[model samples]
Target: MNPSHPATASRHTATKTILFVVLAVALLVSVLVSAGTGQLGIPPQEVLGSLLHRVGIDWLPLPTHPTGDQTLWAIRFPRVAMAALVGAGLAVAGLIMQAIFGNPLAEPGVIGISSGAAVGAGLAIVFGLTVFGEWTTAVFAFVAGLAATLIVYAMSRAEGKTEVVTLVLTGIAVNAIAGAAIALLTFLGDTQSREQIVFWQLGSLAGSRWSQVLIVAPVIAIGLIVAYAVARKLDLLSLGERNARHLGVNVEALRIGMIFIVALLTGAAVAFAGIIAFVGLVIPHLMRMILGPAHLPLVTASALGGALLLTLADLGARTIVPMADMPIGMLTALVGGPFFFWLLRRTRKRAGGWG
Candidate 1:
């Protein structure tokens, strides 16, 4: 139950505000730390100097030597930024999913959106299609994501109502179908295309560049803004759609709009990062546990928390093995999958309704 006393609510709000501030600092620190820890071992000071210089902070001293400066600029910087953006996008998408479904466990992967995106990307690779020119991957991903969500919505809605149980079931079914399609594409692909499909499925940031960062970062920002604007409606809908309607919220339209936003953000993230797992599932819950359940604070906290989680995870992926690069997505799953299992075990007795 929500705390009703004004003093209690204010206290909770204060705590959330502090969390937001701390998370922001942590994200900055993580990015800087990640920038220094890559191959060639750029010194922290040089990383900072190089980054500031590149960003037009002319007052900052330039690095004395070029080796660490090049490492920071050409390699580590792009990877860290990509990880952070992908993390923030997935986290925002997860928050929206949980809000719309009123279920804390609802995430893109659980509901098949990620799998659908992978299938789309996989097919694009297999067929050598690039219809959107330079942005073809992102475009195809958005289409596949939208299609998957629509299929879930149609299957779950009947008599002008959505059944949460049916939605979960339908998502599982769709995810399985999409997985089969991905497998088929992989089998039919030639050796080169097959390697591309494999890497995309595993999810790596090996070849991250500034251009890919630019392509995805805008979509993430726009989607989060849309989600934030409807934050109150999401809170209302959580109380139940009938109550939301009574309170002057347009439940159907809001739900549809939120779903589309989720698709757009999730699609963009997957398109660029290639099926990173559990980011959406883990980050929002951590944020909510720190902040209260209020949508505004929850969403805000989740965005930062997600960015931090992904950025840190990427750092580990790079640093954990000296000679080899690990898939950032795999790192997330390695960490998030165990947490997910524990969450399910902890909540099994309650069996809360799906959001």
Candidate 2:
């Protein structure tokens, strides 16, 4: 089977197109279902109609239940939107990190951004820092996340060169330090603050609002665009640093740009949604398995896949236990932990040993 053959290329393109369409539809369905499920239980058709009505399409009749419109618009829709944005942002960030580091296992959290955000959130909780009013914790988390990424980048540089191994090691050290800081805050805080800190760590979309959706949507949109623009370079970088450079890719610039984009996307996501894990780590790998290593399709597929995974997780979170809003992060961890172990085992098997 010659990959360069016209029929082979055509088949690959057709497969990718079909997969993309399927994923896009799945994401749409997930969003509709997630928006409809809860204690209130609006039907999926009404949910879609409400969405259309909100956007000025008045053809679909509204739900007769008075609060249906309110619940769908003010609460459920925003929550679902946040899930989609955060999921897409994290997935793209993970894909970028994995490509830059040349490691299938790399994720957005590999650089300690999420840990840094958690530490900042801890500080806000413990000290009662509401300088930004309602947004104080989120602001702190976003700033801290960027700060951690910059520190890791600085530490990885030597004589105008950045090594992937050095970067990853620096991230490990930073994450440990951030974790210690969070622990210290936890130890010093009062009971109420302690509980707040725990909830932030666990991650949830419970209080999602349209305002948050507006803020995060643009950032994720911009990050995805930037990521897609550099997708080809990322694909080349995976071949090896020297090989990428030989092919005229500016490895350092590309690395730095990707690092910034990853930080922006991950920071915004964590700021709003807290520390949802596994979306970043799992979605990109799953998409790559289905879509192969092409970054263009990989990035798109990851966004849709992440959105689908989180939407469904949120649905389960709300419904799995009656009258309980389960932490969305816990659900993802439950699914992703087993998947991670399987991935590790598979990688080892392919390499024939740990080395």
Candidate 3:
């Protein structure tokens, strides 16, 4: 078989299509399972029925258990949906950041955006700020996240271009400042507020509400759409800047647009769920490894992979302790930390020394 033959290309395309279908099915299954796993133990069938009923598909039989519909609709479904949104958003944001920086290790949480949002959330919690009433924390978090990204970009830009090393270093400095701000807020807060700050930092979807989901979903959906529209440009960008420019990509504009989208997606995710880590870093990298570096498939695969990961992680968070909800962030960090170490070691070996 000729490796470059048209038949070989067709077969490869067929394989990728099948992989995408499998991943989509897995994500759907994860959602159903996650929605069914709370204290009441709603079966997947009942969960599906409840969802169908809510969407006006009244032909399907309703849940037999008296409280099943209410529990699924009012509680479990919202949490599961939010988890999917946050997971997808974070993963896609990570993919964009990595593309923009041309580094596999780039991630929102690692690059100070999550910390910046955390600082804003801390302020809202400690000071009892109610500028946006119930959404004060979310608004503050979103704005602060964008602010941090802008600061990083401005600091990193030089001679009409943004260097990858400069951006990474700026992220490190911004993260340190954001961390210090959060710590100071924690110190000044009352016991209740301090606890709230701590728990929020650790990240959980415990209080996931339909209202919050409503706000987060649209933002993430829009960001994902924008990302997909530019997927080809991102692929061109993976080539060096000069080559990309020669190919007619407006490199500076693409970077700025991607940065903005990353801010919007990452901010929305953090605002609702706090700082869940590793979904972004791990999912995209894994997807890239399996599907190759084509941004379109990589982005789609990363979204599904992230959604599946978080839904499963949330299930583990709820069920692992048998009655207590564990911190979702802790679980992701536990998984991601080792993976991160391995990634660093591999990259170092590949480069033959740290840059």
Question: Runs in model 2 with CA error above 4 Å?
Answer: 1-4, 130-136, 150-174
Once model 3 is optimally superposed onto the true structure by TM-score, how far is the C-alpha of residue 266 displaced, in angstroms? 0.8
Per-residue CA lDDT of model 2 for 249-348, tens digit only, reads 9998998788878878887888878788778889999888877898998989989888888888998999999999999989998998788778768866
Name the TM-score of candidate 2.
0.90
Worst-scoring 10-residue span by lDDT in model 1 = 346-355
In candidate 2, residue 195 scores what lDDT? Answer: 83
Q: How many backbone clashes does candidate 2 have?
A: 0
Kindly indicate the candidate among 1 and 3 with the higher lDDT.
Answer: 3
* Residues 175-268 of candidate 3: C-alpha lDDT, one tens digit per residue: 8998789889989999999988887689999989899999999998998899899999999988878899999999989988888899888888
Model 1: per-residue Cα lDDT at residue 218: 90
> Which predicted model would earn the best lDDT?
3
Q: Per-residue lDDT for 197-228 in model 1, tens only?
A: 78867888778899998888899999878878
Ranking by lDDT: 3, 2, 1
Q: How accurate is candidate 2 locally (lDDT)?
A: 0.85
lDDT of 3 at 9: 74
lDDT of 1: 0.83
